[model samples]
Target: MRINMKPEEAKDILSDMRDQHLCFLESSENKDEWKKKYLKEAWACDSGAKALEKQIPCKPEEYVPDFPYNIFSTQKCAKCGTPVIGKKISKYCSECGQKIDWGEE
Candidate 1:
């Protein structure tokens, strides 16, 4: 079924569900094979949701760290202050699911 909701809201809901499933898996003593399988499937769905959450495009802002050397420069998400690491930042921010635009060097 189709659901109408903002990307942030949907991501929060999915994150909550994933956290709940993790709590269940950790706290429950039920070693039942069926339940374990079910949780595994839910985990897979959550993984997919993570990719889907990167719907908001945001450009990364370059910054220089306090380190003595300027080589310590890096980029952070403009929307969320999450650091983006790598020779080239990925298409989306891993922390807040903001689509990243590295722009032209």
Candidate 2:
């Protein structure tokens, strides 16, 4: 059995597949291994050269800053200066527990 889809539907499906492929590549420990898999999948989808060209060849590790030891141990909230005895993740005022809105700075 076969099914027919509109051109727009096909495009959407292809786009979603490409995004998934990109995500897989991004998570791969070894990019060379992922490259082979990506190419094979792209060929199966009959993707254009442009799509293959857009494939990322390298995966970057995300950066995370060290936890603020001073703040966590001090029992004070990082954002609101509230006394946080055991709440290490607390960001609100100690007494009122009001959140201190620190907008992207």
Candidate 3:
């Protein structure tokens, strides 16, 4: 699929991506507050990324899941049985460093 957008459009997307990536990378010294703040910032960045995509004027060939899909609902680590927090694409257990099987990709 080839789509030629205006240079300004491309620059907008690049700028958005860079900003979001920076937000994701920023960290705090406080562990508890860091996690909470990180998740909030990540969600904001994700929303911004989606908005940027929507402005691209192209049709998506696949689905994009909504952010914060039931924070209470979680998947268990296949090896250690510890609940996998946050991301569904997590391939490693943060607690035990064991490989996680999240079923079919």
Candidate 4:
């Protein structure tokens, strides 16, 4: 089964489920059936998320991992202010064809 959701949204859902599980444990209720059900669902979601994170790439050479790590290193062009990703040592603006001083020399 596939769920349509962004990685961040999915991660948030997983976190909420984990908290619910913890709450169940603290309440000392009979959660055997619920545990059997939701635990498997949570595991499925978590595994699916991990698989997608590996499959979905984050540009030029970066493979972003979940939510927080999903952000890639980007630099703005000094001449055009266009954000460039996965390029830290660049000395030229790919957008406007202008020479960039990236302080690498």
Candidate 5:
């Protein structure tokens, strides 16, 4: 099953897991073997968190009128410029996974 989470929340979870593994590694009696395993996992978590931290905040650009009646409009992700052709919009860009804030519009 897929789980969705805010970038900050995911980062915090990964950072916490990395810390716990580091603590385990520090106190482990079998340093050689445990170090290899825990260190790899910790590194993975650290990188994942770092990647989330680096994502730029963005929103949907102003919708351009599509039909002559102006009932329909085409919107694009500000970061990725992936066009979204409809009135219904999502909180995140489907193409690039960039967070989108269509605030008060």
Candidate 6:
């Protein structure tokens, strides 16, 4: 039988099933055997989800704003008092054609 479910829903269902199975195994006398078998299956499901997760490419770092920066250079324009410097600033100000000098102080 074919089951139609969204990826997220499928994952949630699988996780719930895994939790339920684990609880059942823990309560039963044959806990060790069930635990091993259930864990193996759960691991397989987790690996499958991981593989699927990798298939969906996330946005590139450059495309995302507010990305973390190690060395942040906060410099104001000597003439205009505009904050300019770092990876976000590719060129001189769009407002003024004046060159921005991030002095190394």
Each prediction's RMSD to truth: 6.7, 17.0, 16.6, 14.2, 7.1, 15.6
Residue 77 lDDT in model 1? Answer: 76
Q: Order of all candidates by lDDT, from best down to worst?
A: 5, 1, 4, 3, 6, 2
Clashing pairs in 1: none
TM-score of each: 0.49, 0.36, 0.31, 0.36, 0.51, 0.41
Predicted structure 4: clash tally: 0
How does candidate 1 score on lDDT?
Answer: 0.72
lDDT of each: 0.72, 0.50, 0.54, 0.55, 0.78, 0.52
For candidate 6, give the lDDT: 0.52
User: Which residues of candidate 4, in runs, are more than 4 Å off?
Assistant: 1-27, 58-105
Candidate 1 per-residue lDDT over residues 1-88, each given as its tens digit: 9879877787777777877777767756767785687598669759867766667555788755666765645788787888786636
lDDT of 6 by residue, 1-105 (tens): 998876556666666765776676676577577778877877776665554443332221222225576365554444444555564353454443444333331
The model with the greatest lDDT is 5
Which candidate do you rate higher for lDDT, 2 or 4?
4
Expressed as tens digits, the lDDT of each residue in 11-105 for candidate 2 is 56776776777667676585797788986786555564333323312211222335655443334434334444433243445454444333332
Per-residue C-alpha lDDT of model 3 across residues 17-89, encoded as one tens digit per residue: 6576556556555477666766666667566554444333221122233565654456565444566655455
Worst 10 residues of 3 by lDDT: 56-65
Off by over 4 Å in 2: 39-105
Better of 4 and 6 by TM-score: 6
Worst 10 residues of 2 by lDDT: 53-62
Candidate with better TM-score, 1 vs 6: 1
